[model samples]
Target: MKLFTCTHCGQLLYFENSQCEKCHYPLGFEPKQLQLFPLVAEADGRTYRLFGTTQPNAPTYTYCRNHADGVCNWLVPAESATQFCTACALNRTIPNLSEPEHRLRWWKLEIAKHRLVYSLLRMGLPVVSKFEDPEHGLQFDFLADASQDGGQKVMTGHDNGLITINIAEADDIEREMARKSMAEVYRTLLGHFRHEVGHYYWDQLIDNTPHLTEFRALFGDEQDDYGQALQRHYDQGAPNDWSQHFISSYASSHPWEDWAETWAHYLHILDTLQTAHAFGLSVNPAAAPAELGLQAAITEEPYEISDFNRIMQLWLPLTFTMNSLNRSMGQPDPYPFIIMPEVVDKMAFIHKVCQQAGSSAKAAC
Candidate 1:
């Protein structure tokens, strides 16, 4: 995510911030502009104009309906007929908010979902909601397990275009326990969103398209029985040399999973590189030996760079700096996984797919 600051006071703000802490001015993210504008309420009490613009022709916007529940900070133009913003419109089911705990869980899921949508928009990928295209449009279902309510245990996965997330994944303790049990190097709500959406995009951008042949060549044939693959993985675990060919042990379960895991990492790299570029971050430790090749910089947006090698050049050094900082603070590495050449080859394929999708969208527009 790009760094944001309040226009009124330049106070650094999080993507979820509803108001500038320093100026106390209300804020709302305008998706088209990719900006969190300080808002000035209209006298009619229905819409808000941007903070400093006085022209009568200036556009006005209103918060998404989810804003009333403090789950969204995105805005839709006042002229728009829809009540939900691009991100919030993806919701097909939200946990019952009458239960106090459910409210927090829903909010947490929304934060990650909103960020996921932001990345999708940044990549110029399609963001149609299930309401727009019931058959294949993206949607989310935040559900509780049978242990919490009276339904079957909810699994975090994707089916067609609908992504189901167990509300328990939002709980830190539960997520940590699952991570340890699975022996995952890293896991988070955002990671889950990115991974599942990868599946949705596979259905949209690759399935039955010309790209499918190349995808099969790169990620292996996804036609293998997915359930059997996962069952074998759980029973016997990954191959001893899994890292030589896969991004993670779970990724070794199936061709589809390998693609999804690589896709998630691709988004991870793009977002983190964007954040670094936003902050003008670079690694050039003066005292470090020159032979280590530690000097690096992010001179431009990762998404704009078509060269996968350039993205990795900046990514590896940034991870080194980030991991060092985390270790210094006695915390786990922010980027715990390695990007071997084989994994990079897979990621490069994802980069090409995303680039093509972006170009196709632009051409249609």
Candidate 2:
């Protein structure tokens, strides 16, 4: 994520900052402007005006009244009719806020959602509201399906651009059980965001771009019978050859499943490498391959798809060490999925596609 600032004092701040440490300016994100503004309240009820010029003439802002009650920190655009801000507006149905525990989970969900959006926006990808584009806009639907033991709703999957997050995934025990049932080594809320985004981008890129032939060649025919593939997966299980080719066992369910799983891993590796760099680790995914090989000689460091085969070599050892460290703490491995050579190539392909798309967009602008 890019470093943000307190608009008033130019003090470095994080994306999650709601107050300026240097100038005491109350901060709020203006989603329409994609900025965090210095908020000043008018001498009236609960309304507040926005002024921050890191973007001059930024859109005016309205605080989520939940902020007054200390339940939410999200901000909505003053001109928008939506009650939730750009982040919270995606909710289809949240848990019963009447229950104190549900409210607590809601805050945690909101925080993770904001972080996920921030990363996506930083990538310069389009994030249109599903509400705005009922036909094709990207949106999320976070809902709770009877955590109280009477309801029977039991899945969280994607349908087109909408992401349905079973709120039970928010519960620690429930998520862990699902993770175990699915034989997953690692799972988290952030991972869900990355995976769901894979489905969204598949809709945005493959469905919109001229890469149909290449997509089919690499992933398989998109026109394949999806329902049949899923049903076959449930009945017969993933192909035994899944381990040699697909990133996960479930990925063998269908070519589209493979694409989404690979896409999620690409994000995971990139973000993990970024975290390594930010923390002053010696690993450099951007470095030359020969240098990486030399580093790999001493310590297995996280690698980048951009670095070619050298990356996979380094990644395996590094992730192995990472998993061992987690095991030492009596926790599951940090990266549950394997990085096969085929998956590495796909990750490289995605990195290149993103780079080309970004450059193409900028040149057109």
Per-candidate RMSD vs. true structure? 1.5, 5.0
> After aligning candidate 1 to the native by TM-score, how far in Å is the CA of 84 from where it should be?
1.0
Which residues of candidate 1, in runs, are more than 4 Å off?
A: 148-151
**TM-score, every prediction:** 0.97, 0.78
The pairs that clash in candidate 2 are: none
Per-residue lDDT tens digits of candidate 2, residues 244-346?
7878887788878888888877767655554454444453334447544424432323322335465555555457667767999998778877666677767
Which run of 10 residues does model 2 get worst, by summed lDDT? Answer: 297-306
Q: In order, what lDDT does every prediction score?
A: 0.91, 0.68
Residue-by-residue lDDT tens digits, candidate 1, 190-243: 999999999999999889999889888878899999999999999999999999
Q: What does the lDDT come to for candidate 2?
A: 0.68
